[model samples]
Target: MAEIAFPKDAMRVLKETSRTFYIPITFLQKELKYSVASAYLIFRAIDEIEDHADLDNVVKYEILQQVSELFERPFNNEEYFRILEPVKSIMPDVTIRLEEWLQACPMDVRPIVADAAREMAWGMAKWSKANWNIRTREDLDDYTYYVAGLVGVMLSDLWAHYADEKTDRDLAIGYGRGLQAVNILRNEEEDLGERGVSFVPDGWTRAELFEYAEENLAKADEYMKSLHKKSILLFCRLPLALAHKTLNAMKEGREKMTRAEVEQTVEEIQSE
Candidate 1:
């Protein structure tokens, strides 16, 4: 068996791609397994195609085209293998399983999934020309939904296939939305400091945006409470619980949360 060592290269891609998601993803592995991890890894590549500058355009498109081919007709090769090598090594069954997933994807889903992927690719496609306009929350919202919200949709399907559909999938979907919002919000300070850009531009001040972000988070909490109170997959609860802790920190008037506080909150989540 391949040792379950960290996929350092893949983890680097994950962290640069989705800073907040990296850790919560560790918890999700217990609930969603390595296939979900590989799927998310693919999205992270898609995300990097949009966000990271060190990468070249030709490289990104090449990667995307290969990804398209992989799902369009699953095959393993050096390029895909080198990139996803760690994942493949860790979960030797991942390739066959991923092909099975695509085969099972509805033929009609090509549009919906393709639309989502394209919307995501467009955002990245134009990353070099990222607009500073704040009026594009709709644009960002659409992007987030396409990339992450759809993950919720797929995850719901994944869960339902393995177990009963939670009457709470709607709530899970809300939690996903809230998570996406918080991510956009959390990156504001960095994006501004780094690039003079803001995702929600003018309608809200940073504090107001933080408040707006938390409103979605609060909805996520409501969805968590709505889950069967006695459910045992409590690890799935980590994301919501962390959202609550992060929101609490925001409410406490800190300009930004201290790393120690955030770490404490994560510890509280695992311990609780």
Candidate 2:
């Protein structure tokens, strides 16, 4: 058997198209890296399927079914295992996580992504599901939490494996949920732009955003305070910070978010 490359392309694929996770996961001990990376790659692929319009629903369904099949078998062909092939060249620790992502499958989630892919799928689905049921804003809120809040739940599970006696297992879910909540509020502008939907910023005012931020941040801080590990904090830092920053950006952008300002903000983040 060959070794795995771990942090190389396989992880690079995991890192692509995001400023949030790449640098942060590196803060962990060597043993924890690939499991986190593997989970990310699977989730990211699912995201692509949902986000990419070029791919048709039938193709997406096939990809989803392939994910189901991959989990049922520990062994896969090079194409299905493309993400792992590079890692197998230089990294040995990857074998375990690679197996985990391949073995366990969840159904209540019916989440088209992998069974193990996390709540983000549910949340995104709910966001779209809102189109048919647009009677109340609370319904919209429920959708965001499903897709994003579940991220908190899965992160807790992943973190629990690496934490020692000092870890506060009790608080992992709260922290994850906090992170998701902040994201939902931050994306209010983007959500409205893309879906013509508004779970928040019904009127788009700085005062409302500030109050919402204060409320959500209070909850996030509670979870952060509950955390006993520095690694988790480091992982939590950039996103929650960026989420907070995005809100401030929206306020600075005011009601009319110009194309230039959003592009500049994204560029600044990528360079950072």
Candidate 3:
């Protein structure tokens, strides 16, 4: 695969959007790094639309479905611009520059990224249409599968493409779900106050949600244990460790880990 010259601003936008992911992504080797970064930015773009505070659910559904359809065919810059024109003022720069992120992927694995993105967009559309109702554990499972599990599946595919590393798909799904569950926990206040949506199922307490997250995180640990490559292990280790620590912090009545603690975790991982 040819080397990709990622836009100068890509890393900046990534850092602004997610410091946790940005750190691990930076540790990845060249082509794999680019591919993973491109995939993340692409997914994050559509995710912004799904979670937009001001947009009505109807509009969110329309835009997300349009984006999903757009990825179903060969990408046409003009088509994407036209599809998003009406919402341009409210859209974030990341969503507006979707094409750039798509093009940033290495050609060999671009299709895989696009396919995963398309599925995610469609899934987001489905939930948007439903106003993100989560009334049961099964509903939560389906929602997380779309928004997070597919991410695991996509990463597994990318790992295979980049390093010929084969992972258990089920475990990979657990890995993604584990991280996302932690996010739902950490952002529960904001999600409810700002968006008026709750990922927590009906009649479930915070403790139950923690149990749900822990179960999936256990699978994540197994997923990491199955990896033999040092780089892949390192890349996977940071987020999992942070997720574990973040959960611990939350259990202790803290919102999240402090900057010093985050840096300490990274240092320990690097030293290992």
Candidate 4:
């Protein structure tokens, strides 16, 4: 695989915003790494807009709608930047340079990236407009599928394109749900106290949510095992291993892993 020069600025922002993802992204090879990293930054930008706690719900909805609509028009640098300007100050630097991110996207994966971003943006708009009232297991599934499951589908497409691996769409969706459910569980306190959003269903206990996460992750495990490429397998395993470990820690009332523990996990996966 030939190395692509991933944007230094975007890499800075990526490392700045997420230490966890930074590790796995390194495991991806060549253009696949470039494509996945750009997609992640684009998606992260949408997430920043959708989850701006201080922004009015109406503003969030409008911004999300506009972002979703961006893919419909011919790609315009200035126009895209302007559309994102409302939340730019609060967004990460990677997000601020969305047009550059788009430009960096591998030509073949551009449509997949755009489509996933638009779908996620629209879903976020719909849920934001509804004020994130997750009331049932199905509602929770719907929400996770929108924000994260769609990501699974998109990644499967990218993996198929780059790695020539036939990925299972259902298992892909399950992988996303498993990771996202872990996120909701870990961030519940902050989401509820600071954002006034509760992702947990009514009458659901921690154990119930943990079970949901575990079951999805079990499918994620299968999804990983099906892949033969070492780079793709390693790239996918880091996150899944972390999510599984994190879920276990959350069950024990710990929300994060120590740096040493993270290194140990990565080493174990790499050795495997």
* Candidate 2 TM-score to native: 0.61
Best by lDDT: 3
| Per-residue lDDT of model 4, residues 1-272, tens digit only | 21354577777777777676777887888788888888888888788878777788888888888888987765676876787677667765666777777777888788999999889989999899989999999999999998999998998899899878898989999999999999998999999999889999999998899899999999899898778888888888888999988887777778777788889999998898
Off by over 4 Å in 1: 1-31, 55-70, 75-137, 167-170, 226-233, 253-256
Q: Of the candidates numbered 2 and 3, which has the greater lDDT value?
A: 3
Residue range 1-272, candidate 3, lDDT tens digits: 23536776888899898788898898889888889999999999999999888888998899899999988988887988887888889989998989989888888899999999999999999999999899999999899999999999998998898888989999999999999999999999998998888999999999999999999999999999778777788889999999999999999999999999999999999889
- lDDT string, candidate 2, 34-125, tens digits: 55655666666555544443444444444444444564534454645564343233333333244433332232222322444534544444
TM-score, cand. 4: 0.94
**Candidate 2: misplaced stretches above 4 Å?**
1-7, 54-138, 165-190, 193-213, 253-272
**Residue pairs with backbone atoms closer than 3 Å in model 4 (clashes):** none
The root-mean-square deviation over C-alpha atoms between each candidate and the true structure, in angstroms, is 7.1, 8.6, 1.2, 2.1
Which runs in model 4 stand beyond 4 Å of their true positions? 1-5, 85-90
> Which has the higher lDDT value, candidate number 2 or candidate number 4?
4
The 10 consecutive residues of candidate 3 with the worst lDDT sum are: 1-10
Give the alpha carbon lDDT tens digit for every residue of 1-272 in model 1.
11143244444555555545566656643334333444455555455444544544555555445555544433455455664443344333333233333222333333334344444445444433434344655665555565466666555555554445463655555667677776666676787776566677456666766665676676666755544422224534666666666666656754446778667766866676
**The candidate that achieves the highest TM-score relative to the unseen native structure:** 3
TM-score comparison, 1 vs 2, better candidate: 1
